[model samples]
Target: MTGAKELDRFLAELTTERRLSPHTVSAYRRDVGTLLEFCAREDIESLDQLAVHHVRRFAAESHFRGLSPRSIARRLSAVRTFLAALVEQGRLTANVAVHVQAPKPSRRLPATLDADQVASLLEIKADDDLAIRDRAMLELFYSCGLRLAELIGVNVADVDAADRTVRVTGKGAKSRVVPVGRLALEAISRWLRVRATLVKGDEQAMFISRRGKRLAPRTVQARLNHWARVQGSPTRVHPHMLRHSFATHILESSGDLRAVQEMLGHSSLSTTQIYTHLDFQHLAHSYDEAHPRARRSRRRRQKTK
Candidate 1:
C-alpha cells in the first residue's frame, strides 16, 4: 500500500478498534499530518524511511516557534502513537519516534479565584429566565467543584436537595457525590422555578439554554467570561478556575488533603498534592503576620541585644 493509503487505514483502525473520541482522533490526525508534510518536503516517501533524527528536528523547530513544553510533549506523544500503529501493522521494523525524549513540561501553578472574587462573580443578578439559569450554573460549578463536562451532564434527578449533595459522573464514567453549599442550593431552587415557567418540556438537565435544551460547555464558558468582566476580576474566568478555587479553599480551611482528593474525584493522590502547595503558601503568609519570631521588629531587637 502507498504511504498515504496506509495512514488512512491506520486512522480507521484508531476509530473502529481503539474507540477513541472524535476530538482525540482529530488531534492525532493533525499531529501526524505535520510529520507527513515534513517527510514529503524531505523526499521521504514511506513510513520506514522516517527516522528518530527527523522527529527530533521537528520538535526542535516547534520549540523555536515558541510552543510550550506541554504542547510539544503532546505532539511527540501523538507521533509516537502513530508510529507504533505502523509497527503493529508490520509496515515498519521499529518505532523510531519511541526513542525520542520529550522535554519536561514546566510546572505552572493552577489559577484560582479568591473567595471574595468568587462571591462577587456569583452575585451578578439578572431578572430574565436565562440569567437565572446562569447564576445556578456558576454556583454549582464553584460550589461542587465540577468539571465542565460533569457540570453540563447534570440531570435534575442528580441533585439531592434533601441531602444537599450532587451526584456527578466524572472522567472515565466514574460517579461521585459532592456536597452543595447553602448559597448554591438557593440559586438552584430559584433557577428551577424560573426554568419551569420558561421551558415547556421536562428536560432532565438541571441547566438549560433559552431554547430549553441542555447547556453546552462552550456556552457555559462564554457566560462565565461575561460575568467575570462585569465583576471586575483581573483575569478571565472559566469553569475550571471555579473548580480550582473550590479545591484550594477546601484544603485551606480543612487541611485535609485526602478528603479534597476524594471530593475532586482525582484517581491519584499525586494529582491532588498540588493543592497542598497553595495551602502551604497560605500558612506561610499567616506565619509572617502572626508569629513573633517572624516579625521584622522582633528580629531587629534581638540583633541589637
Candidate 2:
C-alpha cells in the first residue's frame, strides 16, 4: 500500500524471482532508491501514483547535473527493470518507464599498437626469471587475444605445447581451443621449463608470482606497464591493449570477421565489427598508395597539353 513497502517487495522479487546477481541487485537498488528520493521530493508517494512524466523529469535533471549518457542509461535501465517487476506483481497497472527511451552512448574505438610497436614489445629480452615470465604473459595476451582473467586463470594442464594450442575458459565459462603462434609457444615453453625453478611443485596454475603463487591481475597489469615504458611506447600499455592489437592485426591480415569473432569469444558478431573499422582504415591507406588515380603527377599536366 505504501511506497516503502512496495519498494521492499519489488527488491525481494528482483532477488528471489528474477534471480539477479547480488552485485546487480545492489546497483538496481541504488538507482531505484535515488528515483524514490526524487519522487519524495516531488510529493509523489506510491508505485501506483508514478507517471512517465516523473521519469522524464528525473532524466532531464540527471542530464543537467552533468551525468554521462552511459551512466544515465544504466540508471534508467535499473528503473525500467524495477518498474517492470512492480507491474508484473500487480503493484502498478502498467510500466511507464518503457515509453521513454534512454540516451544512446557514444561508441569510442579502442586504441591498438601497430605491428612494429608490438614487435618491439615482444622482442625485448632480459636475463631475470620474472622478465621471462612477463614476456610470455604479454606474448600470450597478444598471441591468443586472451582476457586478463582468462590468461591468469590458465592452469598447467590447459596448455598443449605439442599441438600449439591452449584451452581457454572464457566468459560464461565457455571453453574454446585457441592456437598459439610459434613465438608465444616458445616463450611459454621456456617459462614452463624454468617455472619449477621459480615456483617449485606448484601445479595448480600455468603462471605464478615469485612467491610460487598464482599471479594476480594487478601484478600482471603492473608488469605490463613496466615493460611498456621500457620499450618506449608512446602510451601506457595494459594486457587488453595487447588483446586489442591481436584482434586488429588478425582481422587486418585475414579479413575473416568470423574467425576473429571466434578468437575473441564474442557472443555477438556486432561486437566484433568494431575491428572492421580498423580494417577499413588499412584498406583506405593501401588504396591511396596502390591505386593509379590516387597517385597524382608531381607536375600539373602542363596545363592542358
Candidate 3:
C-alpha cells in the first residue's frame, strides 16, 4: 500500500477502534508522515524495507533541526505505534521503530498564575458578546481545570447549573463530573442568554464563535493571548497555564492529593503529583521571604536591628 493510503487506514482505525482524539490522531499522522519522507529520501518504498537504523537517523535529524526531546520522543512513540499496528495487521514482519529510542524528555515544572492574577483576569467585565463568551470560557477554564479540547467540546447539555457541576469529555473519550465555581456558572448563564443572538444554526455548543458556530481551539488560544495582554499579564497566558493554576491553588489550600487527582481526572496519582512540587516551590518561596533564618531575611533583620 502507498504511504498515504496506509496512514489514512491507520488514522481511521485510530478514530473508530482506538477512539483517540483528533489532536492525537493528527500528531501520529505528522510523525508517521515524516518517516515516509525519510523512506523516500533513502530509496525505500515498502514497509518491509524499513530498518531500525533509518528510524534512528530520522530521530537524529529531528534533534539536529532543534526539536525538543519531548517532541522527538512523541514523534518516535507515534512511529512506534504505527509500525506496531502494521505488524499486528500482517502488513509488516518487523517493527522499524522498536529499537530506535528517543532521548528522555526533561521534566520541567508547570507555570501557574497567582491567586491575584487569576482574580484580576476573571474580574474584568465584558460589555460585548465576543468578550462575554470569552469571559465565560476563561472562568470555566480556571473553575474546572479543563483541558483545551475538553473546554471547546463542552455542550449546553453538559452543564448542570443547579448542581454546579459540568460533565466534560476528556482524553480517551472519558467523561468526568467537575465542580464549577459560582462566578463561572454566573458567567455561563449570562453567555447562554446572549448566545442566541450570535448563533445561526441549531448548534448545541456552549461556546459559539462570532460566526455562530462551535469555537475552535486556535480561536480560544488567540483570545486568551489577547486577554492576557489586556489584563497586563507579565507573559502571554495560555489555556494550560490556567489548568496548572487551578491544580496548584487547590492543592495548596486543601493538601488533599487524592481529591485533586479526581478533579484533574488523572488516571494515575503520579501524574497528578507534579502539582505537589509546584506547591512545595510556592511554600519554599514563602518561607524564604518570611523566615528570619534565610540569608536575605537575616541580612535585612540584622541591618534593621
> Could you tell me the lDDT of residue 124 within candidate 2?
62
Model 3 over residues 158-271: C-alpha lDDT tens digits? 999999999999888999999999999999999999997888878999999888999999999999998888888987788999999999999999999999999898999999
For every candidate in turn, the CA RMSD to the true structure comes to 6.8, 6.2, 8.5
Off by over 4 Å in 2: 1-66, 74-95, 285-305
Residue by residue across 30-53, what tens digits does model 1's lDDT show? 878777877887788787878889
Comparing 1 and 3 by TM-score, which wins?
1
Runs of candidate 3 exceeding 4 Å displacement: 1-103, 295-305
Candidates in descending lDDT order: 3, 1, 2
Clashes of each: 0, 0, 0
lDDT (Cα atoms) of all candidates against the true structure: 0.87, 0.86, 0.90
Better of 1 and 2 by TM-score: 2
| Candidate No. with top lDDT | 3
Candidate 2 is scored at a TM of 0.73
lDDT of 2 at 164: 90
Q: What is the TM-score of each predicted model, taking all chains together?
A: 0.70, 0.73, 0.68
Candidate 2: how large is its RMSD?
A: 6.2
RMSD of 3: 8.5
